[model samples]
Target: MRKLIFMFFTVVLAVGVISAQDDLSGLTGKKAIKKANRAFNTFKLNQTNGGDDLKEARRVIDYVVKQDDTKEDPKTWVLMGDIYNGFSSFNQAQKVLNPDWENIEPNGGMVAFQAYKKALELEAGNKNALDGLSQIIGSISTAGLDAYEAGDYMGAFNSFRSILDIHDLLKENGAASPLDAEEEYDNQLYITGLAAMSAGQNATAKPFIQKLYDKQYDKPAVYDAMYKLTIDDDVDAAEDVLTKGREKYPDDLGLLFSEINHYLKLEKIEILEEKLKFAIEKEPENPSLYSTLGNVYDKLYQTNYKEGKTEEADKYFNLSKKYYEDAIKIKPDYTDAIYSVGALYYNKAAIVTEEMNALASDYSKEGTEKYNMKKAEVESLFSEALPYFKKVEKLDPNDRNTLIALKEIFARNNDFDTSNEFKMRLEKVESGETIEKSYFQ
Candidate 1:
């Protein structure tokens, strides 16, 4: 009886060990899903660290996936894709353990892409899978662009071709299919055009931009991009693009401004002047158009100044002042134009003062009269500049540059008391101390 009892106990012990082994091997359904989730979280957190912890996370995911519970679980397939999409040393452990990983490309992105593709195949409407796939493809295309910019033609070609594949994928899927269809489409076209441009295939880029234009005719940003692509090689082509864009978007400030800029670049001053005059006629109250005209005058003045045409430079400088004043009249808060006016007067004053100083050093008696006249002219110019600078100070007292300029101007005229007052005000403003309202009044 004792021998039989001992044998029975041994048999029970063996059965218990076998049951435990089966539990580890046969994880399925909900249990497998639960394990996968736990592993996924662990993998995500450890992805940035990249070492043994990552390896352990992959082990957990692999154990669950190998259970072969059900191929119908789209969630499982998606999770698998996520693991592959974010694959690092931890995510690729199973493949590494196998011989195939050795032959896989060194780029982690390509491997991640394959996994995402598989997930998309299992679930066509899977948003996460599609996004992952798009990102991977976009990254690959961007890498190509970097290579091309570095003068690596072959590398750029490969990267651009990968981008083309992504474009094809997006085309096959309708715009409504992706979470961000507009963004995806825009990105795809941009990448396509950029690659073609880098490859010196401007003609190829043209169609991509045209497609984007067709999708959103009023998009000024697209028009600007397309204009840049076509302008250098073909002016007439660029003009046609602008004309069509203008026809569709007559009121687009960006398109109109771009057209004006193009004419200016081609030195078609008459055409540019006509366009600006017409724009001003249409929008008489528009401060920006006046500002643009001021810029043109400023540019002309600079060109003439460099060429030693003093009279012509003065004429354009006066024209610049007139336009800037017009801009300020249209919108009193036009700070940029106000600043420009102040800068013009300040520059004029500096020139006169410099000339006077030079004369005084050479011919003392005659120079005294000239110097006095020049000093009077300088004072007149400063009178014009003072209101604008004061306006700037009022608007932004914290602007140290403007405050310093005010103090220097006051001190230069031997107004020591006023100069000290401005200096004190500056210090008070910087320290967030209050000033008496009576002082300004």
Candidate 2:
């Protein structure tokens, strides 16, 4: 989330200097270091083209780095860093144009980072090592973000981990680190954890997320992750974490939805409106929340109508219609919301039809007038419900409910021909022919 809160940068290809090539057929110790440096400088200057300097650089430095005397020298380690770093840049640049191009050193970036760290350990004030370290850090950060954006979670994690390793070493040596601040450190931890989690490496993810939990990271995402992680092993503990998070962040949209879903499972519909309204306030553009709020009021409408509380039922009916229309305004193609609005009108018409039927036996003057008025209201409700169900039929042609609704509305309007057309389609669907995939073909 939020680009991992990393400062995205274009890694600068900002350093390459040259020196004369030298033969080192029998070179050892300081002579070997001189040969390696010469090879490194020339290779750095010419690696992108077809050049033999990279072979020369690898040949001398690979053997020289293992010698005890050379290994002790900070200059030797600095040269090692430069050679590998240049190799990484060359291979990566080449691969951009030719994806199948061979990577000369696939591990070059990590090797460069390790070599630079070694140089600093040997002599903390080594300027070449420091300069090299600065450049490679940006390179690694850019690579991490690139990998993340490309959906390579594990690759992103490795690059980010290398940056974290460097930051730790810098801290241990009392040097400045870009992620030294507590907030930045926590952000890095969260992102690193997120990458691991996305990669399906929960074992690797636990430690990074655990660090944030221990430090009481303020963001609600941590609590959400922790809740999910703990749920399988300890349900009680998972509930506790969710409870605490909801208490701390009552208004956070994610946490609010978590609570909303919990009550939904428990069948606690009465308490959902306030929570859903709060969620709407947090994410006004989200149609699902408005749809859910509409569903809550729709249930209330059914309950009050069944109890014959017409005024209360009408109030909830209006509320349900309002939120459903709000959701449709936001997402025109939301099938469930569209269908719910149509059902609301249809059910209300059915109730009015029942009332009109009750007056069928009363042929008195006032009773006939009331029945006529109720019949007109019933037809009006059916007319209001017609377009929505027709839209549903177009959006999902195989929908049985939508087809049935269309047939009835058409018949009610004296359009028997159109009603019978849908009736035949409905019969074919119920007989399982139109339900088959071959039907569409």
Candidate 3:
């Protein structure tokens, strides 16, 4: 009698387990769906605790997705994408034993892509799907870049081509397209251009690059590529391209600066000066404007000095000084301007000293009397230059260049005491001692 009871209990337990499995197998109806969704949510939360629970979460998501009744629901497709994305993220953190692994599958991205694609397929003007697809495409593009950097050119190309495919698909379906369809199409042209350029096929690259330039006129890289084409012997062509760029981006200071530099190279000083003046007027606060103006003045000084126009050269030098000072005032940390001003002062002192020496030697009879006056003027000019040199030294005490200049100046003037003091200070500076400021009163 006891053995018979045990057999009957076993049979009942097996039937109960079978019935429970059937209930979980293919849930149907609204109430069943709500239960499946609740199960999915509970599994998703459990997955966050990691460890063994992640596998349980995946099983729940898979089971929910496998339900034939819910397969057609768009939300189910989206949930599938989310699950796949979760797996991918987990795979990315593979080093972690308890990683969220559901995100690794490309199908997840594709599922999201297709979900939106299908949504749009159903309702042609669905903005939500369009936006979601755009996002998925962008995500795919980033993934492609990563693959490319890992030497997966085929992967990169495939990723980029996917975007183009989507564009074509949108066009074919009469769905809304990007604002610049032609330009969008031209991206393929740019990729080809980059490939050709990499292979040194300049001629082949030219047309593609030119088309891109025509579309995006103000892109520096486009100008740069065109500029490289003419760098050897086509200065005129280069100038023409730059002129076009200037016309397109008139307010671009870099373009204006480059134009001025080109004019300077071509020896068109008047035009260069006009451009510089215009830039100054437009951006007076730009320290570069003053620095460039200083450069122009320095160039003028060089020309006048070479032509033996002492007075004209002196005037230009003073103008250079003013411009450089303006630059420093605008940006106190402008080391180049500071250095230029210091060098200019030294040059002025040298010229004045030369004048005094000539006057003293040529007029010996009127010497001592006239010599004292002229020597004093020379000394004053040298004194003016001294402060600037000292400033350079203080700013960069270990600057061998500034030290050499100071040494030469003092040696020439027979101020050995002062020169020796500067040399010691420089040594101390180089040894890591902090130097204090030495200002002129």
Candidate 4:
């Protein structure tokens, strides 16, 4: 009985101590702040290098945050942020000490960010919270870049998104944001949009891209991405976006090209012609533009020829030659333009050959003359294309296309020996063998 009574008294004493500790109504404004600061100092001093010190710091700060008089106080929130920051620091140090210890509790950075954000909400111009927020932003930015470089795009997207969210929240709450508003949004939006698109998260990318477009952000890539995303489902809207982008960024070649591509897709040939002409006007010396225009006319020539409109087909073929000549004049050694010109002559000759093959055998005197004239016309066209193909070979000695063209052109011109040589070279190129000497040279 005496032992039981002593145990009861011990339990009663323990309950009284617990009740007093749990009761924080008496600990208000100044007292609560003082205790929080003291706990913070103890944690910072790292006297014990133990979890107990950090736990105690968090307990005191949380108590201050929960107290009636200090619940709305900016100072209380600042203390909460500091406690969490200390938690993060302690966990980092502990991880260094014990490399295997991975389960660091409470996500200290997130907690600190939230606490700082709350402090700013309560006092928009709070310098302490702003400084802490800046540190958090810097850290997050670093994390995002690391994740991006590692091809962890989703991780990078989340990191960048958090930064934007914080900035937006600060602005929405009438806080004095330290971030350069327009520049920050522009950079973050572009990266986040691109990351989201790369991750195959179209739903996530749309808003970011739309925001950039709406703001007329001076980013050509945004317009390009926007058009690519919407071109299939809503072509008109995509073209409208392209038009607006071009209007705003008149010199942006990307937007100009996107506009050209849109009209090409719609089969609006007249519009395509106009757009290409305008682009050429803007950059008359750009070889690529002339090359593209040449290709466009090549396609049109084929279209007209297929409809049996030989006269119209000849017109487009001549136009194609003009552009190809223009491109070659600007960039004399342009391999692609040179190849296109050669292909044009070769194909036109093939058409004439088809016509000659369609005629009857010319054994009679008059028939022989007609057949020979038609054959000469075919050979002349192939001859015109031959030197251009040879030039292409010199410009790009290892080009597979050039090798194939040389073999065919020689065979057509009845130079069987030279044709066989080019065929051997083409076989070697296809087999990935190194060619020591230039075939044409």
Checking candidate 2 for backbone clashes, the offending pairs are none
* Candidate 1: segments with Cα more than 4 A from true spot: 1-66, 71-220, 226-252, 258-283, 302-310, 362-367, 424-441
Task: Compose the digit string of candidate 1's lDDT tens values, residues 1-441.
Answer: 999999999999789545423444656655755655665676566545443333343444555555666455556655665554454333245454654544123344555565555566666756776666666664465456556777765566656555555455545554222324567657666656656666777776778777887677446657776887878878998898888888777888778888888887877755776688778877799998887787678777767876889999899899889999999998987777887788778877877778777777756677688888888998999878888877876766556656666787888878989879789878987888865442334
Which one wins by TM-score: 3 or 4? 4
Clashing pairs in 1: none
lDDT of 4 by residue, 284-381 (tens): 99998898888889988988998999899999999999999999999999999999999998888888787787665658887777777888998898
Best by lDDT: 2
- Candidate 3, after superposition: displacement of residue 92 in Å? 12
Worst 10 residues of 2 by lDDT: 9-18
Comparing 1 and 3 by TM-score, which wins? 3
lDDT of 4 at 363: 82
Question: How far in Å is the alpha carbon of 4 misplaced in model 1?
Answer: 49
Clashing pairs in 4: none
lDDT of 2: 0.81
Query: How does each model score on TM-score?
Result: 0.50, 0.64, 0.56, 0.66
Tens digits of lDDT, candidate 2, 1-441 = 455443232122222222223444556768787776776677666665554677677777877888877888888888888888877777768878888887676567778899989988899857787677766776677667768998999998998888888787776666677787889888888888888888988778889988887778999999888776776677778778888988888877787887787667656788888888888988999999998899999989999999999899999999999999999999998988998899999988998999999999999999999999999999999999988897777777778888888889899999999899889889988888664331122
Score candidate 3 by TM-score against the native.
0.56
RMSD of each: 12.7, 11.2, 10.7, 10.6
